[model samples]
Target: MSDKRSFIYMALVLSLITIATRATNNMVTTTLAPLGKYVFGFDNLLAGIIDAVVFLSTFISTSYINPTLQSSSRKKAFISANLIIFVLLGIFYLSNAVIIWIITGIAGIAFGLILPNLISSASLVDDKRTAERLLSLYSTSLSISLIIGPSLESYVLSMFGYKSVFLAFLPLGALAFGLSWYVKFPEVKRETHGMSAIKNKGFISSVLSITTYNVPFAALTAFLTIYAIEKFGVPKDLAYFSYIPFFTISFLTRLSMTIRPFNSLRYPLLISILITLIGLTGMVLSPSFYSFLIFMAILGIR
Candidate 1:
């Protein structure tokens, strides 16, 4: 196949696997909450801490997590993220212990490895403009997965055992492995421009804003399900399923704004910040299941 054809095919595969894994993250929190309580005997505060720690670790890892140099190295880093998730997921199936934190750390390491490469890989797959759209499609997959992940997870938990949901992700991980073989990740391009902010306002404020947004984002990823499971005491399945509505609403909102016949790159960065703030408020005050669902949906939109 031609390179263009390969790019398209790879984009589709990336979307499918990414959505599957992301959904697993959103939905699993609730199921694990009860397990943490009854099986591992954790209090709400402690469970929240466990949830918080994962993102905290992810934040720390982000700085160090560059894609490996060789194509094989990059592929290994990419697939290994899913592979690690697969293993930890299996561990979750067997035991509900403090080990989940270790698992979360492993998952975070995988996330760090996988996500940056997607950004870099997008540039390689096509020209810059096309790359953004491709990455957006990739993002869309996760959005769809976010929407579907919760619902699918919820269904699996309700229909089968909670343990089954963990198993559901293995296929996604395997698919990632299969697709990794086909990814002809082009050479890493070098930007001629240096990282100097010629038009910066203040050094301190820039640093503050850059770091602050990640706090809530990380916090939400870590604690949203825990909030639903522990604070609201929603059933594990229902909590897991909540991701569906969240993703659906958010994705629709994005599609509406983005997929117009006209091509517009207006105020996305500003809009994102506003959306995030709004979503963060919803998440923090999300005491009931409905509220958590709303917040997650808003987060998805943002």
Candidate 2:
């Protein structure tokens, strides 16, 4: 294939996988709530903890995976991880065991393996700054999915039971596996550059800082739904919708950053962390709905 044809094919393929991955990201926390309450007979907090099982793995895996694979991502490992994730989704559906948590962990590792590689590959192939704009599309897809996924889950689960959601997911995973086989990413000419970057403490420090910033966003993904429902007693769908404003604000915020000048990422990173902290604090302490909304905006500055 011509290089342009290859890039176009790869972009479409990744976009499709993004949708499926977003679906899984959405299901990880919300679907587990009912499963925990109905099947496991657990209380609200415990159910939320169960949901965190996947996210914890994502954080831990990404932390380790990001650095080692920066200069050269292992495409075969990504292919294998996708295959494992698809099989695990099948096992989760058929078995209906809490071992689904381990499956979630596997999915998390798959995401860890793929996400950084996707970003790194894109940056390597094109303008690094422009790549952020492209990534915004991916993030927006994930954002819109927060709206679509649970709605689909509610309908499918009601029609065919909770297991049906997983059934629907299986084909999507299979599709991702098949499409991943077709993508042809660029080769890296990083032999000397990789050695130089390895010696640069500044580069390592920058990556570590980026990792720290992800901690709060990861925490929000893990806990936001439970915080809304338990702390606020709002309906799940409504609470979810209520929170769309957060991501909307977040989406806009991220978009705005690309055009704006950067003196340092330090200030923005600090601001994002503070916003998340404020939102979490609001979840615990908000005395009224209005107060919570303010906190929600603060939560979104990320």
Candidate 3:
């Protein structure tokens, strides 16, 4: 293949791997809280703690371990990480409450390996504009997975028990494992001025914005279905459907941005913060499940 053709093929492979990895991860995350509460008889605090273990491990791995592995072959790391997750998912099917927490933490470490490599691969191109577009497409793929993952999990939950939800995503783990070999791993570059970039105001603001967004989102992912069932008497299967509109709007927003990115972040960032506040407030005051879904869509805009 020509160099350009090779790049395109690798980009496509990376996107496929991303979709499968993200979808399976989403299934696990969305399943954990309800599974803990209903299946294992965990209290709300325990379930929340179990749900949080994944993020905690991921943070440690990314912040401390990933940089040290920069000289290693990313292709090997990525494949190994996916394989670890695949095995962990199999173990999760048979896991009790205590084992589930341990598995979630290990799986998070695997994700910490996988996710940063994917982002680095997407940014391999030399041209700045092309790199941005590729990153945008990568974001779109993530949104697509977020939409599909919960929707399919909802269907599976309707037919089977919580354990089966983990089984349902096993195929996706295999798919990601298979695709991992085909991606072109980006070469590692040591950054001497990493701290300088961290000192930039743009970088600082972006970090703050992302932190603000993820805190609420993490809470929602952990508790939304439980809240719906307890508060509104939504059926267990249908309770997962509450995520549909939120993820759908998120997918649409990313798809649009990939096609035409904003020229300026100023107004869009401000508007998104405002929308998030209103959406969160509305959800608190919502009297019905349907109204809560509306606010979920609004929150997705952020």
Candidate 4:
């Protein structure tokens, strides 16, 4: 009973940390483009580049720095990463365009460290079923963050300027930092079959499928709100709401999959690809904001 109680407590802590950290991340990524364009008077291309810098730094950190720290203390790494992010959030309020780019890149490195640790912590359980459930819980937490983060930012943007979005997520970053200490990080054996795994057809296909969706998704995250404002001449707050339908539908689809996952990926993958193509086309040629949102929601079905 003690062991079960401990496991449950740890799981809850992990879920809470995931939600808080990922929500702050979502807020930053979704807001940066608009913040750059509107507040800093940047062109769309420059603003998009600023957003891309975050992911670029993240990729560098994940690929190079994270591997060196894998054998270190997960608890310490998690705490430190959260602290880095929380401090960066505070810095955003005083940042110019150049400062914003630099801060976001540093924050991305922290995220690269923190996220993999969360996944590692989730898999510490010996029970396969329990580990799978924990992984699903992690995904659901992320989906929930994606839905709520932008929606909350929209409300904040309605009353305040773009800088306020970063400050608004400060509390969440602090909460995630506080919870990082309670995380249970057990030593798990690392899998050394990466090269062999990459050779598999299933692996190749999965990579392709993920890339197909992620490419467009990443572009939209950086530019969607700006696109709405530019194309439809909507208020910044109303433009921010564009993410609501996209992320809400995404959350619902994720939750349904968690409850009843597909028996076969074949048909679902094919259908999702078709829907994505159609959604992209509709979004480009959308007659109005409502039609663009409808297509955005359609893309979320994947």
Best by TM-score: 4
Model 1 regions lying over 4 Å from their true place: 25-34, 67-72, 96-98, 126-132, 189-214, 229-233, 260-301
- Candidates in order, TM-scores: namely 0.75, 0.72, 0.92, 0.93
lDDT of 1 by residue, 1-302 (tens): 98678767768766765666566655554455545665577887776676665655655544444422456666766776667766777777776575676776776666666655555555564367767777788767766876676666767777776667778766765665565555445554432212334244565655655655566655554455556666788766776565566568778876786676335434555676788888878777866778777777776665
Question: Candidate 2, 271: how far from true, in Å?
Answer: 2.9
Clashing pairs in 1: 147-244
lDDT string, candidate 3, 1-302, tens digits? 98678767866886788899889877777778998999999999988888898878877766656665654565677789899988888898899977888888998888887887777778877888778867877887888888888888889988998888888888899999998877666556753233454765578778868876888888888898898899889888888898889989988887787688899888888888898889889888999999999999989888
After superposing all C-alphas onto the true structure, candidate 3 shows an RMSD in angstroms of 2.3
Local accuracy by lDDT, each model: 0.64, 0.62, 0.82, 0.84
Worst 10 residues of 4 by lDDT: 188-197
Worst 10 residues of 3 by lDDT: 188-197
Error of 4 at 274 (Å): 1.1
Q: Write the per-residue lDDT of candidate 4 for residues 59-86, one digit (tens) a residue.
A: 7766566655544565677689899999
The parts of candidate 2 lying over 4 Å away from their true place are 1-7, 43-49, 59-73, 95-97, 124-164, 185-213, 288-294
Error at 229, model 1, angstroms = 4.7
Q: What is candidate 2's lDDT per residue for 1-302, written digit by digit as tens?
A: 98667656656665677766666656655566556654667676766676677666766666565445433366776677678777877776765446766666677777676555554444444655546645765666556655456566655654565556777777767876776665445564433333455576587767656565556555555556556667778665555444556656665676576567578877876766666666777766989666776777667666
Clashing pairs in 4: none
For candidate 2, the per-residue lDDT at 170 reads 79
lDDT of 4: 0.84
